[model samples]
Target chain A: MSAVLTPAVRRPLLRRLRPLGNGPLFTVAVLVLGVLVLVAALAPLIAPYDPEALDLRSSLVGSSADHLLGTDQSGRDVLSRLLYGARTGLLGPLLVVGLSTAGGLLLGTVAGWRGGWADAVLSRLMDLVFSVPGLLVAIMFVAVAGPGLTAPVIAMAVAYTPYVGRLVHGLARQEKARPYLESYRVQGWSGWTICVRHLLPNIAPTVLAQSAINFGYALMDLAALSFLGFGVQPPAADWGAMINDGESALQQGATMPALAPSVCIVLAVVAFGIVGEGIADRLARRER
Target chain B: MSGPTGLVVEGLRKGFGGRTVVDGVSFTLPPGGSLGIVGESGCGKTTTARMLVGLERADGGTVHLDGVDRSMRPRGRAGRLERARGIQLVFQDPYVSLDPRIPVGACIEEVRRLHFPLDRADRRHRVAELLDQVGLGEREAAELPRRLSGGQRQRVAIARALAAEPKVLILDEAVAALDVSIQAQILDLLAGIRRASGVAFLFVSHDLAVVRHLTEEVAVLRGGRVVETGPTVRVLTEPQHPYTRLLLDSVPRRGWDPGRIAAGRRAPA
Candidate 1:
């Protein structure tokens, strides 16, 4: 690890990262994510004042130094709420989306690599879930399993496993036809080894591209659930809950709650879309 | 690594639905002897090779080595994967026959890992030996197939096939995809390998002239049947079968030479 930071690897990593620094999309995503994550992770460090420690006299107040982004209906500092709220809005989805994407990558890799009954069984079960509405499935799951960050991640993983799995399955089938893969098979390398050593490296670029798309899909799904009150609960504050809270305030003209969270949602989704498109094009060119 | 071992195929029958692609295909190679199968593309030459190596199953037939009739049955489950430990196939495309991601040495070295499972240093030494046998060196082995020319990749492919140290080697159009100059060079390599290792080779080709350059005996296949089989010159100059004569006639002759129909190689109304 120490040697890795030496001149050779670092130079290439910096060169690739250079493109990222200049790209408008990358800059915006990094900025938004950086602020949100920092404020969330170091709430004690940078938050000017306590979040739950509020002055009711400041209730429903508009932005001031003491109450930037203003105070909510309960007089909780909206800025403070926004900061702490990120810990849920961003953190919850980050957890849920990350877990589900990992799950999807695994199933997709397995289904793609292991054909026959393994593919058939996983494909059909995923089809069963894809047949029904994913959001409806998420709702039913929250109803039965009880709503928490974990439940939605589980629900979303089950709902979207087929999407990633199908992509993986298709990619794996194509990879099996590639000359190099055939070379390994003829070498009489065992099946498991071939899948891991040969197939995994070939399939990685496609799976990762699909995963980025999955991350965006998971974010939108989770926010929608939170909007309907099935996601991370409020009073703890979240982007989706803030959207719900700001509806009446919109009539009253305090728009930051609705505006800010929505902006975060759009930014997260578009970031994933841009990164996925870039990777997908690179992979398509390679395939050609 | 190939040629000390022998291969035998008997009554090898494989089919789709009820249509047999390869039917009753049978042959044997004495240790280090070579057998050439000349066939048009669809006459089941590739399928027979695939079955001999167990890539595809034979519905009914037996593959034997050392007079031990191998799972003397179809290409199906149970026919000599144990046998495959010593049998290798050199496919048509040198480009398609190797994993592009690894260095050429790693590809040959893969067989060493399979049969010997040695540590990295020992494996590298073995691979370097195999590469030298195929007219390559450690420096050549370190490069990837993408970096090499078509002929060189094929040479690497041959090195990889020999890595298994098999007694029998199958060359399925191995030189067919190459240009004539390159093909000639590969033919010379194959001949040298055969002479040195006594590894029996089953060379499959459509070009009789190219086969003429490498093989001792030739079997001409037409529609899954051997139309002519004998010593190479006997089959070529003194062709007994009409199809063999027509096939020889199909070979392009020099300027002002008569076409097969005008030369009695083919009938003219």
Candidate 2:
């Protein structure tokens, strides 16, 4: 067999990038995400004025030399708020995605590998979680736990777990059904070794792509929670709360306060979406 | 009769949903002996092989490997590991039989690590030896299954199975996926490995020619039952059962007619 060694085919850069949306869009999306993270990290150094430092005399002012994104209803610098807002905006999704992905991976793999009564019970639990609306769950949690990031983050994590869990369950089951896993069993390897070592690596790419998309959804969900006044109360800079605060300023003819943060939210969400879909598309193409 | 270090299976039965797939199938192999189970698709040859390896639990029967009854699925981790040491199966499809992510070397080494208490260096050396035994080398071992051709990947699968150093190695249509020339090469490789390592072989295949070339004793299965059992030469040259004759005639060769085979298949034995 080694006498006729076939060299592995190396795909060209453009061809490889095709699945990630024609190269340019994926690059732009990645670039936008990178900038958002960097801006969030450097919020204090970058912001010219304190986000909550009020100047009531200049309240509802439009963009000017002093404030690049103008002043909100409270006369606080919208640019500073938006810069600082990225921190909590990204953090909420980060926590939600991290917790949910971990929970989903463990549950899904156990169910798929065991595939008896355990599978039935875990599957039904996942279905139960999936049945409830995530937003509704978050709202309920906030209503009970009192408005805060902890309530929404925990609520959304539980609600979104089924999304990751269901995906992992189906994929884990499919991967487990493959002959290689059986081959592993025949080699005397334990179920844990096979699942963690062989099964997980094979499905990791798809799971990662799913998590990316979930990150985008989580960001939007948390922002929605904040906009409804159930997250990030007054004095704290968060994109969603900034949007709500800017609403009154919008009526007074200062649109930058509302428009700037709204634009940021949309860009961030779209960038995350594109990157996630790009990863998924690339994986699908590779498998084909 | 079973030797001190051989396999003995009696009256193995299995069913899925309502239909029985394998019913009252039985066979035995002596130490280092080679046997082949020849049957048409849906005749339960593969299922029997799976049962022998404990992949699928037998609804009823006994699989005694070296005097230890292992028909029932092992109860715990230690039991499973012990049973796994007794038999290993090389699956039909090489393409999906090995993990796509792990390099072939790591795949082979994993079994050695699991079964043997060898240190890292010794394990590495054994993995290299197994790879060499299967006509592969360091370069091939480092490569993933996706990068290798079907023949090479099959060799890797064989090496991984051999790494366990089982008392019996079952090839479940192991060479069916390869090209004809590659199939011959792999068959030759298996013959060499059996001769060198003294590992008993239970070949499950539909190809009469492959079974004839490889196995000494042969069992013919039909509708999950063994209709005939004897030496390979006798079974091929002078088949007793009409079904075995039909199977032999169905094999494509010079002056073979598929229509006649199809008609023969339609006729009740």
Candidate 3:
């Protein structure tokens, strides 16, 4: 596909990234994501105070030189908690997206290529999964297995599989219908070889775009679970849990406790959404 | 040349949803023979070609290459590979026939690797050779299908089919998509290939001129049955079947009348 591109069209780096969305907003979203990841990675070094330390005398103090963004109701520094919260905030969604995408690719490719009883069964299973709301599944799993990140993450991963699976199933089925696949089969290439070598690569970009968008949704869902006390228990400094813990602080006139993490969650989710949509737009244009 | 090495298909039958698409279609092409099956759309010419290559399983009858039965759908990898060595097909559409993401040279090399137990170096050499046979250069070999023109892609498709080293090669309207000049070039190339290699040609086409040019024997199909069968020259110049005459008259030439052809086409056989 690259062979058809003219040198003039291929020259600019910005032109290549243009498919990710309009220039300035896409760049800003990427930058926000980059900063969040960096902050999460270097939380220990960047944070000025221990996120879990309780300073009762100084609790609920407004922002100052001593403790920026003020202390939460529990006296945990809001700024430090926000930085540390990035780790769990990003990690939960990462696991959900990774697991679901892998499962989706496997099940979808098999269903699409085989296209008989296997397709019917797998498609029905996916439809069943699709019928259930992801958050409801996560909450139910949390109720059964006790509250923690593990149960909800696994549940959400299973719940999210249908979105990716259905997309991949449709795309793979369309791709399998192309004459090239039949040509390969006619050449005596095995079905496995044709799928791994030709079919997967062609559908990879679209799947990648979907995964990017799924990452954002997964993040928000996980955060909502944590807020409901079904994920990331207290003192672990999760964005969703922090919002919950800061509810009392909001009434005490220290909005930074709840407001700061809320802002961060919204920023990360919106950035991921923009990046995913941009990539999808670019891929659509390239196909056209 | 009449030895049992070439394709011998007898009474091939296929029906979709109780409607017979190909019914008791039969033909034989001896080694080095060129046979054309010509018909209008829905005449089962394409279905017959598909059955020959084992892409479509026949409902009944047999397809034999080199005295081995290959009529049934292959059971396993070994069965499929054995059948592939017997016959190969070059599809009608060039644009969608080759894998878009794969380079042309690799596409040819893949078939070579699958059919033969050649080392990587030998496979590469053979790939170059096959490309050269199809009038493509090393530069085109490294490029993807999108970079090449329709004629060039068709050439690559031909090269890929030849790499399988099959005894029978089925061209299912293989040049129908090309313009006149390119079609002439492809026809010349195919003629040269036939001379160079004794691979039997099963040319499936609707174009009377192409059938006349490329085939020695011709089978005229109508309504899922052969309406006429004879030497290409005899069939084109002095068609015996009324349906064959209608087909020939339908071809545009000097003073061709669309109205008369339409009426003739509308009339029942």
Candidate 4:
């Protein structure tokens, strides 16, 4: 007449799915980014009109049916440009995330695993890179490479990979010393399996968190480059370019141009933050 | 006396910092024969035990199992998998030994997968039988380490050690934490297991009473150095070295009858 308490059951993936939209802010932010990614992914289909179509005769006009949100200094539709801009903003961040995670995971795993001279050398170099702000690095990169979306993303990925790498390096180092890992070592497990299987699974959450933080930074850097006229060149509807154009028209009492792009940038960064925080919280709780 | 290969220690030496922890200790046992190592706290009993199973590195000396001096520490995937099948350990704190996140059934199942490569149903059946052999209910098979009592955790640890079913089982302070009565029960279980399966045991403890009751041969260590060793009963009743004798005396003789014993010895004073 005895019973046992099994270890905590692993909840099914569906059950673990959070009500991500339960919080009003998280929900609204997700919706904005969702619409943004969708707009960017299906830009060929969803954009109502040619983003760069000129209507110079009616340039700088106020909001109306012919040119809702008004025309820019050029004849391009402001709304159309905004929709088109999503491709640049979203694509830049996605590319940065991919490149940084890839580079950081390899470097961090090596540094954490080998440690000693290798860890010391890699970490110090990363520290030096991290000392410089990512935006500054992107600016420097654009100055050297010339203005382009890829240039800004690459710059950000390089700058941010160090942060993600160090985070992973620290976690990987700690995981290697755990008893289970040592036991696995004595069990004749290859170093590769120990690294790939146990080390990766445990360090994944940290890497994921780093990626989220980096993704936010990458988006902002892209936006910054766009603002400076180094990214998502003319004829494209980028948030930063929208903000840039809006700033000039500010003297003429046009505020929506600036406000729309500014809001989009904030929403995108905040969404990445929320998703990162969510993943971090789930991982931290399980560790307990 | 004979079954499979026996464990051999030839001049095994290990040190940490400036102090030598296990100094040139050596011994051999018939496969499945139980040998208890008795030592004080700072002695190298645990360290020597760890070296045999490759848990800790021995600075000098060779560990020869079946007359083969092993080189190349088993590390990484294939090597670790091979080591898991070859040797297994039972740690002191049953509370902290088995991973909390891993269930008992799954923990045992892991060994089978790594070593035996059994079918799913057989693995499940073997896991249940292992739990039963260790005196746990079938329902408790799926439980985690936290849900089990200290004795039960130790039992599960024992079950875990047996899962690998290695040629040598290194028990490092394995059952010292249990209550006196519970200690007896676990010791009995270990004895039964040794009798049935020829798993050479390097049982480490500071407890004289338990070692006397369970082990066939005894090795007494003093500061990582084996001072005296012989048959378990002889070593207990008539220890040669002063250090070994002090270790025996420290057990605090129980049930002394002052009046009855004094009456028999009277005339002296």
Candidate 5:
């Protein structure tokens, strides 16, 4: 019965979800992402055949009755392997984004909010980490940790932590200098309270955008690792491993296996990029 | 009658990078009284006000809250927070003085929560009352700081400070950024609040008219030193120090000559 329009009531849910430049492109991008997520979630139930089952009878064939996309060199259904590949494909990036975001958020807030020696020490550490290329760092860590999916995932997280840290550090510093923080200080609110409740929320949009963009990077990095045999070992289905398996078959005229996974990786990366750019545009518009 | 239980600052000194910013500043504000600290930009008015409220630590001085020496108080977090409840500061820029993420209502309630352990219903009622007191409706309280106009934001800032129920309120260039009409409105509102609350005010400003209108007494600061101090009306109309007179003449009035700038500069230092 209340006629007053609160912020929650003012903007409808659908309108709010529409990021900047809400046109056909935004619609298609969101739809593509939704389909990817859904397919990833329903892979086990919807896949026609066991992804790992070796079948010499159906090996090295094109589209047929039993196999939709066709069988690979091992006679494993390429469609099934591709579908199951989403599990590791999505999980590794998620781990990279999660670990880096958490670690970076803490270190960045500390460096940004508490200036003087804390800032100096943390900033220099970040610089030292940043000097090394992320992939190289990941490879180094994987080499030490003994190569596996988890090893590369942890390595990628450590590699990207500095990047996320730098982004959040810059943003947190900007928010720290704002007058609201001064007001909080004068009000006797603890520095931790101000940093968490006030500063974090203001800088969250940037964090969200950063994570979205980093997701694409993480996907590519993990895929590259798997391709090099550092991540997602054999007998397990992954986009990168599938591409590797399909490479030799490409010359032999069985092109579908290698090409399908490669296309999916491209689509996923592009989708994440679009979403990140849209969020950034929306934030810019809001500021203006 | 209560033996002068008011704010008193003596020999306040602060320096930045080996250079003194606020030097030996001294002032006293009786309970329910108002004192204006007026000066040009970077004249250390802000630094002085900040030190008085413990926002900035003084290099050397004594700050007494209601005759209780607060300078040597324990420097722990809880102790500092308790001291914060005794004196609150309203910052100069209202646009960035509030968290844009939170609505105005929750902002006020946040201050309330720090001082009082009121339950949900009581906090909500108190927040609504504070909103009304600050001339903002409950509807506006539900909105974020960015959604509010500059004047409304300043009022919210004031309301937040008042929620602490401070014994002494320091307004550091508080009304300096508002539009003329809004400035007048805020000044009037402040006067009304003082009348109702009897809160001692350390009103820091550059505007002579605003200082004269709001404060009972004035302290003139020049080059980080208090050059003149007296009743506002007497000091404005019949100043003692040459610097104070120069400051008064600098105000844009009818037939104010531009040549007086040189003359004033030549006055005895």
Candidate 6:
């Protein structure tokens, strides 16, 4: 398929990425995601103070030039911690989306393209997996594995696989029924090639939008897990962990530290939702 | 021209929920032959056409291409693909048949690349040639299926099928979706290509006019069975089966009045 690649042929794809209407929403979503990713990537360089360094004298201090945003109960720089927190905040969801999308895509395509006994077995397995609520399952796994980053990440990845799998399976089944698959089969294209090259490309936008939506859910779920003390143990800067750490500050009449991370979590989720919606709208328009 | 591969089918049968859709259908087309399977909806023509091209597997029949039983073709990836390339099927709706995401050139190149080991430049050149053969130019090849008209998309689909170098081309209501004038143009194009390549054709259509124009031999199907089989002119002008006569009678006659038809029924009453 790549044998005919030309620079001229790629222009249409680039144009497709730029959403025609709802320009502001798409632009804002992209800008928000870009800023967060840049901040996470540049955390070591841009942070003013060590995220873990303790300043006992400055405990519970409010926002200032020396320690922006304020100091937590542990006297750690809130700004520095928040900036570093962006790393784990983003990485966890990235892991969940990546693993689940891959697993889901594979299983879904198999179930979809080769229906009958295969579809029945895989779909029943998905049903079994989907029956378990993701957050509850993650908590249970985290309990068994002991509280840590690896535990929650694994738990959430497993929990979310069925959701992505079902989406891909349905799309694959629908696409499988189309005449193009028959055409490809008659042309001697392998079933694998048809699923990967042709079927995937058609369903990719929807899958991508699904991934973005999954990202938001994963982000919120991970944050809640950390808040419940099952993810990202203390001494590590995490938005969710920071929010938990700053909870006592709220009782002490110092809400900035906790509120800051809470706001960041909401912003990240909202950004992903906007981006997913934008993609879905663009796909619908393109189909029309 | 290279001599065509003859296709022979016998006792082809298919069923869904114990209801047979194609029951004991059989036919033979010699090298460079064109056969039309004409029927109305649910007549099993499409099922029979699909089975002959390996799109739909037959439960109880043998399909032989060029004296080789299709089932006896090799079983491995390369071998199966090689056998599949010997026959191709073009579907009814060009809009749904071609992938909307890929450009028309890439669609054609996909089939070519699978069967041929040509370099990139040669593949691109061949794609251009195929497009031109179907009455499309270089600019149209760069566009996606959505960018083309119904007729143009069908042309691209035909071009893609031709890229496989098939000995037999099965068109299952392939042109039934196009406008009458566009259908005429596509039929002419098919005739020209057939003359040049000598590929045998199994043309399935509900349109008797199109069947008469594109096929030499006609097989009229009704209720999952072939009711009449003969030359197109013979079957159309002197239909032996009552079902065939009923189908031909359904076609509207020019200058015929509905009031006169009512008057005829009134005369019988």
DockQ scores of all models, one per candidate: 0.39, 0.78, 0.73, 0.32, 0.68, 0.66
Docking class of 3: medium
Best by DockQ: 2
Worst 10 residues of 2 chain A by lDDT: A2-11
lDDT of each: 0.75, 0.90, 0.90, 0.77, 0.87, 0.87
In Å, residue B29's CA in model 5 sits off its true spot by: 2.2
Q: Write the per-residue lDDT of candidate 6 for residues A57-171, one digit (tens) a residue.
A: 8999988888779899989999999999999999999999999999999999999988999999999999998998888888888878898788888888988899999999999
Per-residue lDDT for B6 in model 4?
76
Better of 1 and 6 by lDDT: 6
Summed backbone clashes in each candidate are: 11, 0, 1, 19, 0, 0
Candidate 5 lDDT over B26-79, as tens digits, reads 988988899999999999998998777666678998998877777864466777
Error of 5 at B203 (Å): 0.7
Error of 5 at B79 (Å): 1.0
Q: B9-71 in candidate 4: lDDT tens per residue?
A: 778888889888888887877677778888878888877876776767779988766655554
Model 1 has an lDDT value of 0.75
Model 2 lDDT per residue over A127-215, tens place:
99999999899989988999989999999999989999998899989987799888987877778988888888889899999998999
Higher-scoring candidate on TM-score, 5 or 6: 5
Instruction: Enumerate residue pairs that collide in model 2.
Output: none
User: What overall lDDT, based on C-alpha atoms, would model 2 receive against the true structure?
Assistant: 0.90
In candidate 1, stretches whose alpha carbon ends up further than 4 angstroms from where it belongs are A1-14, A17-55, A66-68, A79-114, B1-5, B16-19, B68-81, B118-121, B255-269
Of the pair 1 and 5, which is ahead by TM-score? 5
* Displacement of the residue A140 alpha carbon in candidate 2, Å: 2.4
Better of 2 and 4 by DockQ: 2
iRMS values in order, in angstroms?
A: 3.1, 1.1, 1.1, 2.9, 1.5, 1.2
Q: Which residue ranges in model 6 land beyond 4 Å of their true spot?
A: A1-20, B1-5, B71-74, B118-125, B255-269
Q: Write the per-residue lDDT of candidate 4 for residues A189-225, one digit (tens) a residue.
A: 5667668866787677778876886777788888988
lDDT of 6 at A229: 90
**What's the lDDT of the predicted structure labeled candidate 4?**
0.77
Candidate 5 off by > 4 Å: A1-22, A64-66, B1-5, B16-19, B67-77, B118-121, B262-269
